[model samples]
Target: MNNPNQFIPTPYTNSVDSGNFTWSAPSNIALVKYWGKREPQIPANPSISFTLNKCKTITTLSFERKRHGGFSFDLLFEGQPKESFKPKILKFFERIESYLPFLTDFHFTIDTRNTFPHSSGIASSASGMAALSMTLMSVERLLNPEMTDDFFYQKASFLARLGSGSACRSIKGNLVVWGEHEDIPQSSDLFGVEFPFEAHEVFQNYRDTILIVEEGQKSVSSTVGHDLMNGNPFSEARFAQARTNLTRLKQILIDGDLKSFVALVESEALSLHAVMLTSNPYYILMKPNTLAIIEKIRKFRSDTNVPICFTLDAGANVHVLYPDEYKGVIKTFIDGVLSLFCEGGKYIEDKIGNGSELLTVNS
Candidate 1:
């Protein structure tokens, strides 16, 4: 077999019965916005987010050590094998190995599943990678219990970023800020820090109604999204809008005001998509239902006089945000919208969720 401690051209599967490790990572919706990544690898642009309650992804990492050989890992998505799902997995392992070089030789088997629908534009990548980060940390603890939270976070967060730019936020709880520039102390790899205010205390009055229609995947990924945004003439415009949204949203979050929060959230989502509209060849991640949902939202907001905001990530799904107190009312509204639009208004409902951890670790 190949030497794992050293470099091996091919990946290998573990033979020993690897212990199980599980963790739940939340799907984060960017409030401040991260239109561009500075590093793309770890992302250069600073970002902020809210940890959703309902949307989550769980991950498990097990290891089977060989007496004298290299090891490999298998990824399972929702119990199905994740063959060639992403090259980032290997990159992630490599990043971790740099810190704990001693683990370079072990074999790995990873299994991940999302509580929310996958490819439904629900920030699956963020939660998936965050779950992986926490799972890996659990494994590390099992092998070496002396590691500290700071150490684990620093290393694991970086590792998670290798998988997906937003995954780093998933490792954090409540609210998190991705790396940002100085002149402001808000930016840094800080995970698990509660927002200055209580999430439930402040956001107890919000809701999100998502409409999942098949507008088809974009030719560009978020990485590409940032790339195009960087060169597009509207790049500076997007930046200005994002800055304003961030400044205003921060105040709303602190003030614990639901109305202002929803407005800012909806506006930011629109601004992000608008940039994609003017991209070089034209890229729009929206289905007819998406537009319909927007119209419905406008109508609903006007009818109820309650502010319900809608946001979309890189995917073609629409996420509706409202007060927690309005879930029942929102659910009814969502059902009505879906019923009226028939199959076009399909979508999965989700709330904020906790970040990653290990549920099981089989030895």
Candidate 2:
């Protein structure tokens, strides 16, 4: 499964004249952030994430047999034709066409919608691409009915990574690790693997309440941010630090050490931004409200002795993470205090979840 050649489909044993598939894939928050990457969507450092529940993307792909031609596809977002999204889809098709040869043999209509706002830094691309990859795998399965469940998911994740590196982690649930980490068995840079070890019960139902400090599009794209790492003086040390932190976090997960968890997760989040701040063409993604929320979270945790912590994506939004047992107190804290920092008081309540779902398939 590690070899990319294994994912290439053999000649179709069955023919599908027309078919449709629908899948829903959830977004994921990296506990060990994956900030930089190599070419072909490979990560520079290993990372693990908690798959989210409420924030997800649902996609339906319908295809009809067409005369042999180049890739032909139409994309719709929330039932509206979105021309801007086609280029990305087209590029994804080009990247994956070799693996799924049937792509050019059919005309595809991709209809997608996201529960969370797009490009607002909730990893919309991760969920969106994961959902699409899962849907496409259904078509592959139709052509090759003998495909095993393991092979199906592995290929889906592999394809998703080609679309977005983080998207691979969105394919699985609860805990997923991406990149070749020595401490994590079965870890691979090619696709995300389920965390093999059983985590302490305390982490089973962890909650993530995303405080949307600023929902507008970020000034710098993640692609540009990753590129800036090329000349970052601290790039090597940062990657080394992430590896060490991941090893420490693995033990913390098993022991259910909330204190250590809080420290590591927050440090990793800040370090991710620190790397950005120190890059050659440095830029800041955190807004004023973002810093305000972080300070408030720290003050509330110190005053109340609540095991709450904050993590940020490559955007201004802050993900308020806490154990499920403390949901009641945390909800009050968010409502009374944190919401004031959010734009229009916007936020999303979510929790750890089991991964993607195949909703329907018709042939």
Candidate 3:
């Protein structure tokens, strides 16, 4: 229950000061999935992910002193006011209020936008929550100038996890692991850490082209999915299997074992949906085209000897992962074959990113 990066600080700057903070956080596709959770948004199983580019959320927080000491905020999506998002934003602030006690002293104007559509099935919550966390932390940095960059992200990751479990991973770039695993050093249940070992160059520039099979909200929310795991018959076995996979994956990444990487990545993706399918009141998130895309990816890999593979989130979209060397061939395959299966022939061409970024007013 001990969190090493707990935030407890007295204000070091004037409470009457006003400023704006902006940050862009990327959405990550879990290479090893974190399906269920425990208290305080701790992962039931360990997860590792590839930080994505292009698909991200940018959040800006402009703060001003409140006349009376109480919290207030306006939530804006893109550029317009969004009432539906206000409740979730309010709830997130409430959860993290203890970590940032100065919230009640100011009124905030928050503006957020996503590069990809919410209907695209990318983990928007992961990117969105991380952006908000980083923006808030930037404010904290202004108040207390002594905070280090490393500690800033560590606390940002911890705060983001409290809002959404997968969000912690979005705070770091390249590959990140979230959960307390013995095989991984410095791993914790409270926040995500950048994968500690050196990654092979092959994976360093890997591309992720998201195929949107269903462009709408999912039937079963991730919250409900995690709740079902409480009584899941295979919960214990799944957790054990995840631990084993994390250990194997770490070695594969370091050794540049592409074949093993493909097998493990594909298997983990299927296993995630499999658990959902076998739950008590089973629900299937995959659409008809989802299976078709997977089949095509397998056939393409077999025929061309490319290292392309697919992974899925808690929704029906497909994340096609491959190396940079095969970019031309992959794009051709997408345009000629895969594009036909896409919803309105739309798929995002994004690569593994250098992690998230902060955009200041001066910058």
Q: CA lDDT of each candidate?
A: 0.66, 0.93, 0.89
lDDT, candidate 3, at 190: 85
Looking at candidate 2, the ten consecutive residues that score lowest on lDDT are 115-124
TM accuracy, model 3: 0.97
Model 3 per-residue lDDT at 207: 94
Q: Which one is best on TM-score? A: 2
Please give the ranking of all candidate structures by TM-score, highest first, separated by commas. Answer: 2, 3, 1
Tens-digit lDDT string for candidate 1 (123-201)? 7778888888777666666555655676666556655766777777777666766654332343553222334444446
lDDT tens digits, residue span 1-67, model 2:
3678988877889987998999999999999999888888889999999999989999999999998
RMSD of each: 5.8, 0.9, 1.5
Model 2: lDDT to the true structure: 0.93
Deviation of model 1 at 13, angstroms: 26
Report residue 295 deviation for candidate 3 (angstroms): 0.7
Give TM-scores for every candidate, taking all chains together and pairing residue i with residue i.
Answer: 0.84, 0.98, 0.97
